[model samples]
Target: MLDQKLFRHPETLSALSDSLARRGFALEVNRISALENHRAELQSKTEQLQAKRNETSQQIGIIKAQGGDIQPLLDEVAGLGDALKIDQAQLHDVQEQLQAIYLSIPNVLDDSVPDGDSEDDNVESHRWGELRHFEFTPKAHPDLDKIGLDFESAAKISGARFAVLKGGLARLHRAIAQFMLDVQTQYHGYTEVYVPYLVSGEAMRGTGQLPKFEADLFKIEGKVAGDQDFYLIPTSEVPVTNLARDSIFDEQDLPQKYVAQTPCFRSEAGSHGRDVRGLIRQHQFEKVELIQFTKPEDSFDALESMREHAEAILQKLKLPYRVVTLCSGDIGFSASKTYDLEVWLPGQGQYREISSVSNTLDFQARRMKARYKNKQTGKTAFIHTLNGSGLAVGRTLVAIIENYQEADGSITVPEALRPYMNGMERIQL
Candidate 1:
C-alpha cells in the first residue's frame, strides 16, 4: 500500500503514477484525485459537526444552570447529531473507496529496474558453472528411468498437476529440502521456522496475495457456521513474512530473518497448458522460503545478500545457473525489484527459474502494519520486507535427476546432499 501522504503531494503522486505505468498499471489519477477531494470535504464537515455538537452541549448545560428553557437547544443538538451522522457515514464510505484503490495499486518500480514489457526483456546478470555435455541425449525428469516419479497413482487420487514420488526418489526430494533448510539456517544466518500451511485471508493480504490474486489460491470454507475462510499458503512467504504483521520492533531488532520449508498450494488459474508434463508447474509443490524484515534503507542490500544465499545452494549442488534482473513489467505486484535464479536443466536443454529474490521496500510492511522504531529520531516507520525461494525442492530434484543421470539411467547424488542422503551416493532402480 502506498503512503496516504503521497496523494497529498502532486509531484510525488505524479512520479508514482509514472513508475506504475512502467509496470503496465494505469493509475486513475483523475478518479483518485476526485475521491481524495471528496474524502477531505466529508472529513472536514464531520469534524466541524463534532466540534459544534460539543459546544452546543456545553451551552445547554449553562442554560439549564441558569434555569432557562433548554428545549430549543436540545432540538438544535438533535438536528446537529443527525447531520453529523450523515457526514460521518459519507466520510467512512469515501475512505473505504480510497482504500480499495490503494490496495489494487502495484508497488512503484525501483529506479534501477529496466523498462520492458515481458520476461524476454529481462537482463541477465551472470552465470555460474558449465553446462554438462551429455554422452547420450539427456532425458527430461519424467522420462528418466525407474527411480520413482509416479504420476498415474497421483492422478487416480488427486487429478492433474500432481505427482507422488516413492522409494529413493521420495527420499531424495526430502534430502534436498533438508539440505536447503540446513544451509539457510546454519550458514546464511536465518532462523528456521515452522509455519502453518493454512493461513487467514488477512495473512494472505499482508503478503500481497489476496484481493488481486485470490483466484490463484485454494480457499477452504469453514465447516462450522460463521467460520472465516482459510487459504492454503501459496508459499511459506505468506505466513513467515506475516509474523511481523501489526508489530513494532526496536531499532536493534531492525532485521529479522526466517526460513521455512512448506508445501505450497496454488490454483494455477492462469496457466492452462504450460509445463503440463512434469513438476515444473504443480498445484502442490515443496519450497524452501526465506523472509526478512529490515530497516527501509538497508532492504536493497539485504535483497542482494538474500540472492546470494539462494545462489549458494545451487553452487554447492554444482548446478549450472544464471541470475537475471526482472524488468518492471515482469516483476511481481509487491516487489519493487526482483532477481530470478534460473538453474540449468539438461533435460530441457535450457535455463529455468528455480528461485526469485525480491525487495518489497515497505510494500508488504505497509499492508501488514509491520514497523520499527527509529532509535535516533524516536519515531516509528514501516519496515521493508523481502522474500525469496531459497530453492524450490521439486525443481531442484528435477535439476539433479536430469543433470546427474548416467548412461544407464542411475543418478549420481550431488555431494552436498550425500550427508543428508545417509552417504548414499547414487539413486538407481
Candidate 2:
C-alpha cells in the first residue's frame, strides 16, 4: 500500500532501498514518516480553510447585493463558517491519520535485494538437483507413520497442525491438488479461480495480511461483542489478491492472471516449535495460488514470468529445483521483488520453499484500490499486485514425497502427474 504520497517522499527513501533489511522495512518507514507529517500539516490547513470559504462566499454575495445593511456582512460570514468547520474537521482528522499510516506500509525494495535480518538472511539464488543418496537410510515424512500417513490421526482430529489423508494417501493428496490446478491452469496461463476461504479484514488489508501478518493468520467470527471478525484465508493470496478489490481495470486488463486451489488457514503463530515434523509446518494446507495483475512496467517482468511458472512445475516433475533470490530480509509483505521456488528435498537434505515469486510493486494496488487504465496515458494507475506458489499444494506433496522416494518404497508418479493420477504409475501400498 505504501503510497501516502510515498510517506515523506524523496521517493520513499529511494523506494525502501531494497527492503531495508528485508522486512523490518525501515521501522515502518519511520512510522510512515510520522504519519506523513501529520497529513502534510492537515493538508495545508485544509487549503487555508478552503480559501477562506471562497472569500467568504464573495462577501456574502456582495453583502446581500448592497441592500441597506446586511448585518455587517453577516457577521463576517458567521465567522467564516466557524473557522471553516475547524479547518474541515482538522483536515478530516489528518486524512484519516494519513490513511492509517500509508494504508499499512509495505512494498519498496528490489535493489538486487540480499541484505539480512531473518531466515538466515535468505540468499541462496540457485542450485538444482543432486540430493537423493539414500542407500536405505532415509524415511522421514514421519516415517510414513503406518501407510495411510495419518499423523496421529491428524493429532486426534484437528489438534496440532492437522492432516488426515487416507487411502492411496488421499489419492496422493488429491493428486497434488489436481496437479497444481492443471499446471496453474493449462500451462501457466492461470485464471482457474474458486476463492473465498473466508476473507475481509479489508481482504486481509489487501494482501499484506493485515497489521503485520496478524500472527500468521486464522481468524473467523460471527461478529459481536467487539466486532472486527472475518479471517481464515492465510493464502490464495487472500482471495486471489482480493480480486481487484476496489476495481478499475482495462489497460487491456494489463495482465490479470490467477489460479486458486485454496484451503490455506495457517496461524502457525510464531511457528511454535518449527517444522514439528511431517509435511513440515502446517495448520491446514493445500495450495496452488499464483495471482497477478501487473502493470508497473509489467511488475519486474511479472516476477520473471512468475518464476517460470514455478520452475515449470519443477521442470515437469523431474523435480530437482532451486531459484531463491529473496534477501533483503527474506522479502514478502507486499514484496518488491522475490523468487524462492526451492524444492529438491530428498529427505530434507536442504532447499525447501516450494515456490514464491513476487513483485508487489504498486504495493497491493495501493491497498486494494486495484486500478489500471494507463494505456498510453489514459490515467487510472495503481496496479502492480502479485502472488505466487504455483506449488505448495502441500509443498508439492512434500516435494513429491521426498523427491520420488523409491528404495522399493514406491512413489514415482510424476510425468506431469500421470494424467492427474487416473493412469498413475506408482505410489504403491
Candidate 3:
C-alpha cells in the first residue's frame, strides 16, 4: 500500500500515477480524487453535527432547570444525532473505497530501473562462468536418459505441469535445495528458517500478493467450520517476510536476514503454452528463498548484496549464468527494483531465470505495518523489505542435467554437489 500521505496531496498522487504508468499500470487518479473530496466533506459534516447536538443538549438542561419548556431543544438534538450517524457512515464508506484503491496501486519504480515494455528491454548487468560447448547435440532434461524424470505418472496423479523424480534425479533435486540452504545460511549470514507453506489471506496481502495476483494463487478451503481459508504459498517470501508484520524493531536490529526452503505452489494462470514441456514450468516446485528487513537508507545496498548472495550459489556450482536488471514494466508489483539471474541451459540453447532478487523499499512494510524505531529520533518508520530466490531447485536440476551431460548419456555431478551426492561423480542409466 502507498503512504496515505501521498494520496492527501493531488500533485504527489498524480506524480505517483505517472510513475506507475511506466510499468503499464493504469491508476484511476480521478476516482481517487473524488473519493478523497467526498470523505473530507462527510467528515466535516459529521463533526459539525456532533458539535451542534452537544450545544443543544446543554441548552435543554439549562431550560429544564429554570422550569421553561425544553422540548424544542430536545427535538433539535435528536435530529442532529441522526444526521451525524448518517454522515459518519458515508465518511466510513468513502474511506474504505480510497483504501481499496491504494491497496491496488503498485510501488513506484526506482530511478535506476530502466524504461522498457518487456523482458527484451531489460539490461544485462554481467555474465558469470563460461557456457560449455558440447560436441554432440544437447538433450533437454525430459529427453535425458535414466534417473527417472517422469511426467506421465505425475500427470496421472495430478494433471499437467507436475513431475515425479526418481533415483539420482530426485536426489539431485534435494541436493540442490540443501546446497542452496547451506550457502545462504552459512556463507551469506542469513538465519535459516522453516516457514508455513499455507498462509492466511492477510499474510498474502501483507506481502503484496493478495488483491492483485490472486488469480495466480491456489486457495484452499478450511475443513473445519469457522476456520479461515488459507492460500498455498506461491513462494516462501510470503511467510518469511510477514515475520515482520506489525513489528517494531530497535535501531540495532536495522537489518534482519532470513533464508527459507519450501515448496512453492502457483496456478501459473495465463501461462498456458509456455515452458509446458518439462520442469521449467511446474505447478509445484521447491525454492530456497532469501528475505531481509532493513532501514530505508540501507535497502538498495542490501539489494545488491542479496543479488550477489544468489549469484554465489551458481558460481559455487560452476553453472554459467548472467544477471540482468529488470526494466520497469518487467518488475514485480511490490518491487521498486529487481535483478534476475539467468542460468545457461544447453538444452534450451539460452539462459533462463533461476533467481530474482528485489528491493521492495517500504512498499510491503507500509502494508504490513512493519516498522523500526530510530534511536536518535525516538520515532518509528516503515522498514524496507527485500526477497529473492537463492535459486529454484527444479531449475537448477534442469541446468545440471543439460549442462553436465556426457556422450554416453550419463550426467557428471557438479563438484560442489558431489559431497552431498556421497562422492558420486556420475549418474548413468
Candidate 4:
C-alpha cells in the first residue's frame, strides 16, 4: 500500500502517478483523491455533530441543576444522534473505499529501475562462465526422460506439469537442495529456518501476495471452526519474511539473514501454454529461499550482496549464467528493484531464469508493520525487506542433466556434487 499522505496531496499523488506511468502501470489518481476528500468532509461533519450534542447536554445539566424545564435541551441533544449515526456510516464507507484503493496500488519503482515495459527491455548486468560447447546434438529433458526422470507416472498420479524422479535423479535433486542450503547458511552467514508450508491469509496479505495474485496461488480451506483462510506457500519467501510482521526489533537486529528450503506450490494459471512439455514449469517445485531484514540506509547495498549470494550457487555448480536488471515494468509486485539470474541450459539452447534476487525496500515492511528502532535517532521506522531464490533446486537439476549429458546417454556428475552422491562418478542407463 502507498503512503496515505500521498493521496491527501493532489500534487504528490500526480507526481506518483506520473512516476508509475514510466513503469507502464496506471494509478487511479482522481478516484483516490475524491475518496479522501469525501472522507475528510464526513469526518468534519461527524466532529461538528458531536460538539453540538455535547454543548446541548451541558445546557440540559444546567437547567436540571436550577430545577427548570430541560426537555428542550434534552430533545435537542437527542435529535443530533440520528444525524451523527448517518455521518458516521458515511465516514466508514469513505474510509473503506480509500483503503481498497490503497491496497490495490502497487509499490512505486525506485529511480534506479530502468525505464522499460517488458522483460525484453531488461538490461544484462554481467555474465559468469562460458556456455559449454556440445559435440553431439543435445536432447531436451523430456526427450531424455527415462528411468530417473519420469513424467508419465507423475501425470498419472497428479496431472500435467508434474514430474517423478527415481534413483539417481531423485537423489541428485535432493543433493542440489542440500548443497544450496549448506552454502547459504554456512558460507553466506544466513540462519537456516523451517517455516510452515501453509500460511494464514493475513500472512499472505502481509507479504503482498493477497488482494492480488491470489489466482496464482494454491489456497487451502480451513477445516476447523474460527479458522481463517489458508494457502499453500508459493515460496518459502512468504513464510520467512512474514516472521517480521508486527515486530519491533532492536537496531542490532537490523541485518537478519535467513535461508530455507521448501517445496513451493504455484497454480501456473497465467502460464497455461508456456513450458507445457518440460520440467521448466511445474505446479510443485523446490527452492532454497533467502530473506533479509536490513536498516533502510543499507538496503540497496544489501541487494547487491544478496544477488552475489545467489550467483555463488550457479558459480559453485560450474554452471554458466547471466544476471539481468529487471526493468521497472518487469519487477515483482513488491520489489522496488530486482535482478534475475538466468542459467545456461544446453537442452533448451538458451538461458532460463534460475533465481531472482529482489530488494523491496520498505514496501513490504510497511504492509506488515515490520519495524525497528533506530538508536541514534531514538525513533522507529519500517525495516527494509529482501528475498530471493538462492537457487531453484529443480532448475539446477535440469541444468546439470543437460549440461553434463554425455553422447553415450549417461550423465556425468559435476565434481562438486560427486561427494553428495557418495562419490558416484556417473549415472548410466
- lDDT tens digits by residue: candidate 1, 76-145: 9999999999998889999999999999998888899999999999999999998998889999999975
Candidate 2 residues 169-269, lDDT tens each?
67877877887678778876887978668776888887777888787887767674366688888778878888888899888867989888877878788
lDDT of 3 at 3: 85
User: Pick by lDDT: which candidate is best?
Assistant: 1
Candidate 3 Cα errors over 4 Å, as ranges: 54-74
Superposed model 1: Cα runs more than 4 Å off: 224-226
- Tens digit of per-residue lDDT, candidate 3, span 310-390: 999999999999999999889999999999999999998999999999999999999999999999999999999999999
- C-alpha TM-score for every candidate: 0.98, 0.36, 0.96, 0.95
- C-alpha positional error of residue 197 in candidate 3 after TM-score superposition, expressed in Å: 1.2
Give me the displacement of residue 342 in model 3, in angstroms. Answer: 0.4
Q: What does candidate 1 score on TM?
A: 0.98
How well does candidate 2 score on lDDT at residue 298?
74
Report each candidate's C-alpha RMSD, comma-separated, in the order given.
1.0, 18.0, 1.8, 1.8
Query: What Cα-based lDDT does every candidate model obtain?
Result: 0.93, 0.75, 0.91, 0.89
Tell me, by TM-score, which candidate is best. 1
Residue pairs clashing, model 1: none
**Model 1: how far is 410 from its true place, Å?**
1.4
